[model samples]
Target: MHRSAPRLSRILACAAVPVMLVVAGCSSDSGDKKEPDSSESSASASASKKAEPTVEPAKFAALPDPCKSIAKKTVTSLVPSAKSKSGTAATSSDTSYRAGCSWNGLDDNGVKGSQYRWLDVGFTRFDSDQSLGSGAERARQDFDKQVAKAKVAEGAKKIAEAPVSGIGEQATKITYDLSKTKEDFKYATIVARTENVVVTLTYNGAGYAGAKTPSATDILKGAEKAAKEAVAAVAGTESDKPSGSTAPSEKATDKEDSPKSSDKDSSDGKSTNRKTSANKSSVKKTS
Candidate 1:
């Protein structure tokens, strides 16, 4: 009976050992917080690291109003007797990014044929895009597209392209002729890119009722003048502003040619007064 009692006591002690261990484990679990899963923790850390900064700031922050881009005098000069004197603004949800204006008119002549004219100016501004490129680069791409579009105008003939200096960062003049309404129409399109802004000005004219069609030279000159005004407007300057329009190349050419012209006049045995007169005539012609 004593040995049996001892064995029973030992068995009870063994059972109590397992129970105490279980209780201790439960207590530790309740008191200590659990660690997060490794995969979830890694994902959270990666998400925090993926944050990136923005690229360079855009050059131009906003665009000017379309209808007011060109001066009223300029509009009147280009499209006399326009149907709408105030100019028509293009439809856009965001005028600060893009805007345009257009005008069309017909000038009546009693005996000769009547003249018809159309003009439109557009301004586009770009903001820097991190995934794409800088604002200026984006504007350059758009400028090329505008030039191409002008060159491929439906039924355009005698297309000519010339690089124009002293206008903007870069500029090009494109001229072509198209027949519409049984009248010969001359077109001049100027595409210019300055900073992050792109300016496109188009001037077209036609003659009706046997009127003489406008010459390409005249049309191109008008377009260039208007384009210069548009560029100036983008710079928030006067239409006839001359600042930043003088090309170094042109200045250098003038400098190099002035002495040569004077020497030639002197070598020809011309008097100083005659040379001065010739210079005046040349200046007048250039102007």
Candidate 2:
């Protein structure tokens, strides 16, 4: 009886060990499947929390100089000079107009000369005397005519569509009928803009019954190229405003923040002179 009892106990122990091993294997397999699923879920959540990509503002990178693209280009410097009675009227003093390369007219007899007399109004300030005359009434009339003929609104719209900065007013076309002289002529003016600067092209020729007149298309294209290049040169620098020190504001803002009388007198004298000259010269020329 004692020998039989020992053998039975040994058999029971061997059976128990096999059952325990099977249970342990099943548990390990379950843990491995659950862990893989959990890892996948965590990775998906992390990807969901990631931010979307963003874009920065469009900066004017290093573009080729617009002046370089055009031939016969000129640059001028404008400075403030005088003050006026109402307040300081800004004027151009110590201003210089650097002559550019000459434009040979397409026509054989047309004037063969490089562009000359470029005027640069350093800072744009409001002036009631923007008209081209000595007398107030005459000045007013000239100003009205200029503003009306230039079609400022239309030109500004076109400029707005252009690739350049659409910040300022620009004039594109002008026509005048001067039939008093035997060699009476019709004049036209066109302008293009880049950023805050305006480049104007003028065409003037006798409109006699059997005479030939020069077309302004070539000159206009050249001016546009030069204007673009000038803008590029200016943009390459730190500042875009012509008056490096001044900030941009609406035209109305300029009227409200008018300069002092003394300043106006000093700065506006030269502008007034130019306006007077423009009025006297019926042949519409641009600077």
Candidate 3:
């Protein structure tokens, strides 16, 4: 009876060992499959959270020196006898993105009023951002803001706004009159956008101590020319392009006009030929 009991106990132990092995194998296989799935899911989620790429490259890599953005000739004309020919640059933390400079002068004329002039140039550069917008588009928005800001300057009167062509990708000329120091001042503000850069130039002057105030047309032309120079500087190109005049739309108009003019000439030629035919028929009939 004791030997039979020992054999039965051994048989039970062997059956239990196979069951444990099967359970262990199942648990290990399940864990391995779950771990791989979890890893894959985590990787996919991280990828999904990644930011999208930018649509286009930034137009202007860097900004030009605000003091040097305008041509020397322009600066001389706008601000004769300027206190600082080099211009006083505005303090900014990031000059690469934004900068400004200004010049002011008082040309004294005894008994005749002195000529007082102020010229300022500012530049803003935008970089392409995945979430924001293309640099050029961002600049365009800011350009409009600059123009609006110029129009609302304190003490400004008789404000005028005009779209200027041939200076940059787009440009506006704003003129206004202001009274300061009991003298009338004339101002011309040019806000232009070229690629990713926005440029704002202000040319203002007054005749002081009995001098005659500067003319608005002169200021407008000077501001536009200086704005063109600034835009060219931002593009790192030659400042030789006509303001707004040579724009794509203008070129298209020229092309359309050329065809229209040619058609008119052709019609005139056909009319002349018909007249000649009529003359020939009359001569033939008379003969």
Candidate 4:
């Protein structure tokens, strides 16, 4: 009986070892907090990312008006006359020499009459020498050479005959049929000198058919007026020098030679009122 008791004691001790180990594991598991659920952690990360702020692009301001610098002036003059049979007429005012021409038989009907008019302000002579401060003369010579090379004698003659008048100077005018040659149109050029600068205005148009011709008299008048205003705006009066006391800058010369903008949006590098994205953003912020 004693031997059986000893063996039974040994077996009971072995069984209690495994049970204790199990109880220890259960207690340790119960004391530890569960790690945050992977799904919850992922959701929190996603929410944090979603809460981040978004940035928007900026807008730009609109450009200023370009023509605001130009001033208003009485820049044009018009003289009307009865229709003449001859292709030419002339007038001599105190300050201007004016001439004009009309053609009736360019086309089938006699109703179309293409009239040409020109003005020459003889304030200064056309000098061949460049040292005489004859910039106008130089330009005229260059233009004449170009026209002659182009074989536009009739066109030149017409320009030569347009009516011209100016302040404190003698002006001349000439008019002619540009379609006298096989070409489809004609041009009239006016060269005048203001108090401070020289100006040349040219008008080109198609020929007349019958008595109803494209009248360029008004156009020339407008051009002359515009030129006078432009000169006065920049150079002031004949005796008054520009504010800088120097000759008109190259920019003025460029403006004179450059092609006139036909429309407001013609895009010759003029400032536009277009608002950029930054400008729009600024407007929105203000609102």
Candidate no. 1 TM-score = 0.64
lDDT of 1 at 21: 100
Question: After best superposition, candidate 2 residue 258: deviation in angstroms?
Answer: 42
Which candidate leads the pack in lDDT? 3
Q: Rank by TM-score, descending?
A: 3, 1, 4, 2
Cα lDDT of all candidates, in order? Answer: 0.80, 0.37, 0.81, 0.39
| Model 2 score (lDDT) | 0.37
TM-score winner, 2 or 4? 4
Better of 1 and 4 by lDDT: 1
Model 4, 1-287: lDDT tens digits are 87899899999999999999999999878656344466678889999989965432111011101121112122112212213222222232311112122222222334555433332221222222324444344434544443343344533444445335662132333344565444444445455443323344444445343333455665555545644543343332223333223232223222333456334345533444344656788999999
| TM-score on alpha carbons, each prediction | 0.64, 0.26, 0.68, 0.30
Superposed Cα deviation of residue 35, candidate 3 (Å): 3.6
Ranking by lDDT: 3, 1, 4, 2
Which TM-score value belongs to model 4?
0.30
Displacement of residue 15 (Cα, Å) in model 1 is 33
Residue 123 of model 1 has an lDDT of 86
Off by over 4 Å in 1: 1-54, 237-287
Clash number for each model: 0, 30, 9, 47
Instruction: Please report the TM-score between candidate 3 and the true structure.
Output: 0.68
Q: Which candidate is the best by TM-score?
A: 3
